[model samples]
Target: MSDRNGNPQDPDNGPESPHRLIEARLQKMAELGESVELYPYGFDRSHTSEQMRADEKSLTEAETKVRYPGRIMAKRGTGKTLFVPVQDERGTVQAYFRKDDLGDEAFHRVQKLMDIGDWVGVEGKLFRTRTGELSIHVEDFTFLSKAIRPLPEKYHDMSLENRCRRRYLDLAMNQESRERFRRRSEIIAEIRAFFAEEEFLEVETPVLQSLYGGATARPFKTHHNALDMTLYLRIADELYLKRLIVGGLEKVYEIAKDFRNEGMDRTHNPEFTMLECYAAYWDYHDMMDLMERLMRRLARGISADGKLKYGEVELDFSQPFGRIRFMDALQDKTGRDLMAADDEEVAAVAREHGITLKKGMGRDKILDELFSELVEPGLVQPTFVMDHPKELSPLAKAHRETEGLVERFEMFVAGFELSNSFSELNDPREQRERFVAQKALLEAGDEEAQQLDEDFLQAMEQGMPPTGGMGIGIDRLVMLLVDSNNIRDVLLFPHMRPEQS
Candidate 1:
């Protein structure tokens, strides 16, 4: 058949064939309604496929009737009996349908109208097939929902781009993908449970704010119609969560959606989930212990021996994660003391490393570029790179022993910085100075620099106790736990470019 443009649009052979298949399914739907009560949708399910399988050994054929709802995954047999595989959220089970049991009319209707990808309510009893596979013997059935379009062929091995673009189809057709998301949920639940057990209250903060600070990231701006003011999607919940600490809600955490108007990559998503937690009386040292415990807990939840394998690397979370001072590691890697280097020296070092220097780049930015390019990628094991230069950690408390350094650490694993923690700077005067410095960076063309939030400063002036704050990239953590190489793998719907029409 030809398309609207009169081109040779092979409806049977070309890209438009899927539309033809949809039309065929729609026609079947219309025909099926002629004889039977189509009851195209229902949710009265007695047992999921997994539950039925678990209870299969105890269930006797024709004695324990079961009502299950699932999508038809595959079909076989052509004569009086048919074996179809049906998949629910939990798992898949083979269902045996006999013409004698279902009645000739219903069997004929199913034979003519039922298609793979259609949702069906199956009333059956547990039975073992001739091949000894556990299955359901169909007594009666109902067509739950019609799937007009066919699922992708070999969906489990489909290209990443297509899989992400049609995530619902991916979830429907790919059991591994569904299980990965299920594990993601389990991990998040465990994390919440861990925090709650530690007496930390799970709290929520604003996603939209009049002013954005807390993290060094570009903000996504929006306008509040009622207030007639510009609002920004929060890049981090750090400042606000700390304000709660000041208000005597000492132990608090938030698992929230943080937006950064930034580039996307294997580890970075523009919109991502972050777990930001704060403890009023704690410091960075305490945070390090908490982080280690948390990682071990997550690792144990996934693997019994507190070990997790990401790609080819097996990480031992039970072992104490290694720690090296940030400047020491930078110098060890680059043979240059970044803390002692002036801007000219840092710029020269950056040039030596073949790093691109942005216009108006300061010493800290130069040092950061050098570390990311030369040092970060080699951090394969679980390690804490600690004691950052003050210039790189404005929100962190200055190190008591080190003159120009702050008590901050970034936990790195498999070359990805999973979490950042700081012995938070609670001195209002010092915080104002840091904000002023950040403002200077903002003026000097650093769009990702932290903003000077006067309100947060005022809250600080109201006397917040010494606190430790940590922010974890939950997406990156999930990627590590699930052995997913890309951040997009964990995210249900990551940001993507506009599809060509």
Candidate 2:
């Protein structure tokens, strides 16, 4: 069988194949009138070697007489006897083959037809090798599928750039990637259970909204052929979850896909999952308490002591998270009081910090850029950076004492923003004014600005109760739980540019 690039005889290049050779080989087999194998074939044993390793007791020969199915990863030796490494979803196990046992015709067929990467089901007796390595002694085997291309050799050192580019092969060879995803599934289950225990009803919302009003990010737009109208993929589920609150649902949440038309990075993706929930009659502080508790619970599920080793530091999620005001962080880091700084004074501060500001740029934009550059990276531990500038937060309630600030708190962990919470503004008049301000920003050429959602305003006009709401970055959380350094590692199928044909 040939590899993707047509040189099937070449083993070193097999792992990087795009299945071109494999597909071509299958077509050739069809022309040769060779029938493909079927699955759900009878098997006495289904336990994989990896599963067996995790089991409490040892498996006996009588138990090993069962059948196991998996893909053949490697083959060694030749002629009468051979050793093969077979991998299933759970793990890999060694299989021993003898020429005498199969007889001459069967042995010839095995030598000619069987190739690495082929899916095979084997019925075997269980035994330990002379070296005490657990193995399956094959009595009969069936071709589950023929694989033309060989897999990459794991012994050689290759660049990670190549591994990421050909992730399917990487997944085939790497155990760590598989384990991380297993942990990711566990993390999601634990969080889902936590929300269910809290009596929060998980709900779904429209992904395509008429007006993409939620967070301050650019949105991917699409056109419907039937109606010939523009629609946008949601940037956040914030507005929909809050609408559920207005519908008299006390607590509502949604963990679903959100699309943002933004730049890709190690920490950013054009499309990602956003977990948003809202509870009536609760404030930002209450949300903070619940948020931290939930995080600690998730951490406990992922780690032995409710703590994780990130880099050289151990981040303990067991204790109460610290709270600091936005202005306080700015003053501490930059030695300038953001509350007292006027336009001219803030402009000078920005200039000193090498920040350029446009004409008519407000205090909020200046302060935000400054904080993101200086203050955000240093917040390694879990911290609630609260009371943000009013211009930056249109949906949050006004700060109790600060005139131009809002009651919002963003939780940062491991130098990444994990969650954003706020006491939602419910007054119809105030909501209308906020939307107008956002509309003005959009008109002024801020494409990232939010559009005015009249329908959402009408929902508020129905006298919606004051509420607490939050948006958590599920990918970032999974990254922390799985100890994954890059965002792409946690994602099953990360976005990638199409390789040149």
Candidate 3:
């Protein structure tokens, strides 16, 4: 979030100056040391602002005493009394403090040094003000903590960069930021609940791997000091989860952090969360069905009616998701069957479409490019872009009906690839052949090509069953549910460029 309102200010400040404001607060803290502990160890409290608000009716009727601790967000009036809004995590409560209630020294101490953003514990009886608003008539108060610098004046007006960078300020000042992240947590929980209902066991996988070979993405490389061998941060959890399926864990899912050494954008992040699952005896069709059901569950969990408006587009989860074959969609867009075309023909289509082909860029990659460039953007509604070419999905089983295609489908929503699934290839010999093809691509200078993992091949050779695997970009899913525009908005602390000193 950008600080569009310029800099925050202190109560007595004229124009903004950070050094002056901080130094002034520091001096005040030193003075307050004589009357109270500026950095006190703790403040005993009976209720949060939310709890206080909830019990207000009974408490006010009984004239009950309550202790509440929270950060001061707003301060009003002067002279012998003041009304301040003390905010805790859930909400805020109005606190009324007067010289008559606390006597001369305590009230004088508060008036002299207490500032907005300071945390205080107050003992008070609940009552309504002249305007009939619920308020705490303070009997006593204690200083808990002090904020040396003022908070941003207009937090919502902050730029995206600033809000993400200074998430602490954003959470403190803006209710929307707090609620958005809380919604992210709820969405994740709902996903887990949906899988649990389907009896998929939640599992853990390694973050670092001996060899990475799930998705077509470069990995963040690292060295193991003890073993003294090169290890790569996992780019996806597909391989390990598949191994679990081979070991007879028929249904499994992992919500994992994956590192991909790639470009960063609104949809892409170097480090992101992924939900990868594999099921034995299941095919891509079963996985697609599961995705649709899960989407409906997640939509209702985040919003009522299972419907949402993201920017100008309204996404309705109440209806069935649309379906289109990968090749069919591409052919419709370009008025030609580029899928049946030869390697050179595909390359020509790519160039004609203004997609830059790298050194090892093959026909499958070119086809994917064409789809992404031409057909993907129009997938505003939920859709399954199904039956991709065999070369494009090295780990997917060959399609039962189609000659050159694999049983693969990509779920696209709001023009973004939400998930990818495949009827996983189980024949060890065919798997080896696919690995060889990928190896050839790797040798031809494709940094994003999947490497042949001998151990993974060995597992497949050990009579692995026909399995279905799917991976959901959890961050992207959260973005759609929460209506977040950037991937960074969902991530607590997304990867960023180092500050230039």
Decide which is better by lDDT, 1 or 2.
Answer: 1
Q: Positional deviation of 437 in candidate 1, in angstroms?
A: 1.9
Tens digit of per-residue lDDT, candidate 2, span 125-228: 77777877666777887767666665777697445655666677777777777778778888877888988998889999999888897899989899888999
For every candidate structure, what is the RMSD over all alpha carbons to the true structure, in angstroms?
A: 3.2, 3.7, 3.7
* lDDT of candidate 3 at residue 54, scale 0 to 100: 83
lDDT of each: 0.86, 0.81, 0.87
TM-score of each: 0.93, 0.91, 0.93
Pairs of residues clashing in candidate 1? 40-144
lDDT of 3 by residue, 392-420 (tens): 88999999998999999999989999999
lDDT of 3 at 57: 84
Say which candidate scores most in lDDT.
3
lDDT of 1 by residue, 416-476 (tens): 8999999999999999998998898789888988888999999999999999999999999
Candidate 1 deviant stretches above 4 angstroms: 1-18, 39-43, 336-343
